[model samples]
Target: MPKDPANNICQTHIFEGIYNKYSKGLHDFLYYKYGVQTNPKDKTQEAFIKLWDNCKNVTLAKAKSFLFTVANNMVLNEIKHQKVVLNYQKKPQRTYTNETPEFLLEETQFLEKYKIALANLSEEQRVAFLLNKVEGKKHSDIAEQLGVTNKVVEYRIYTAFSKLKAELENFNIK
Candidate 1:
């Protein structure tokens, strides 16, 4: 049977109520997941607008999960778009000063090696590492945002760290 417009309105109202209660948390979740470069606020707003538009199709009990899933998809899309933009941009040559030749050379080499090590990580491991180490997200939160179990998140983070540490073993950063 076709649903009534009035019923849709009621569902939307309920979704809005749920959104009002959870928007801040959702925004924080996105920010932690994607970081500042991806513009979490705009993405969060867009996600909720999508939710409001599809409110009739989403049940109250499922609204939270739906909002998170929608928001994550938006973030992933933004990341992919940004990656394309970055790949097309011209690479600038870095110039080094001679005042501290030893320090500068070491720093440059370390950065190059670090980049290579990071590139070696799997996408999930890389994301987990950045979210935990750089963004300071708890394992539970990372798991929730990524739709994975906490144990899995922990394993990814550990694997990333192990790879980085192994790759960077020769570097004396101190």
Candidate 2:
């Protein structure tokens, strides 16, 4: 280990620490956002390599953001280069003889309001809330993935629920 601050520049130990702390999160983020089409693992590694090549200039506070930005840009560039047409089909409506038309209409309206409420959340709040609720991630897992503390994750989820609850107060949640 280099004891001198000046000598620690791009040191092996420093690089390893950065890689260890961020690799899994970066990989998971890329995979979640781009799916298999972006070759997320490869793109994640490319981001790390880019970071390593510029290690001297990257501070610890900015490293994570830098990695994500590079990965996002790479995926965006690849997307622009390829013309893709998705074959999308809407799902058939549910039919239940036991339920009244009014009930079905209410349910559909509730779902629409819920989606609108979710969409209105700030990006960070939405990400935290979705990772915890939709993805079934524990607070610790979300914190690790977000490079934040568990308390921050808790706060985010709590606030998200508060906002959603307030937004949907007119609906019957039962």
Candidate 3:
């Protein structure tokens, strides 16, 4: 049927005619492509609203094309947004510790003092001490790495511990 040229889609009756003609097809298109989960009915209504908003730019001949295009794009955008939300939900949540501020400050201060104490050690003593304590090596293994006797390795480690104990005595470091 030939539409009246005088009454554009911006008019209530003409707009209603366009809605009646294309709303169902557009809704079905979105439903078939993305399913009911994507809210095809709402998207179809939104598309018609957009058409009305820009009715001056859209002709009766182009109204069907405009509705389908707008509805399809809206559904695709919503699907992409849902995927992002799902991916975010799947990520591992970060765990936060409930340490008090004073305790955290004390821990930080102790670490700083410990670093200074380690720095104060003689190179030979530091090497043997770290290889044994930090790296979990035995005195015999440390002696082999340092090309020294086990007794020498033991002496260096013992001196390192004694110095560290004295340096960190105020903090009660073991």
Off by over 4 Å in 2: 1-9, 84-174
Better by TM-score, candidate 2 or 1: 1
State each model's CA lDDT, in order.
0.82, 0.83, 0.88
Residue-by-residue lDDT tens digits, candidate 1, 1-174 = 555554452365765678688899989998887788878888788888887888777666677898889899988987898888898775765666656878878889988999999899999999999898879899999999999999999999888888898889663321
Per-residue lDDT of candidate 2, residues 27-99 (tens digit) = 8998888898889989989998998888777776688899999999999988876644222224455665898
Better of 2 and 3 by TM-score: 3
Q: What's the CA error at residue 120 for candidate 1, in Å?
A: 67
- In model 3, pairs of residues that clash are none
Clashing pairs in 2: none
Q: Which ten residues in a row have the lowest lDDT in candidate 2?
A: 83-92
1-174 in candidate 3: lDDT tens per residue?
544666588899989988888888888998999899989999999999999999888888888999888988998888899899999999998776789889999999989999999999999999998998888999889989989999999999899999998889563323
Ranking by TM-score: 3, 1, 2
lDDT of 1 at 49: 87
- Please give the ranking of all candidate structures by lDDT, highest first, separated by commas: 3, 2, 1
Better of 2 and 3 by lDDT: 3
- In terms of lDDT, the poorest run of 10 residues in model 3 is 165-174
lDDT score at residue 84, model 3, on the 0-100 scale: 100
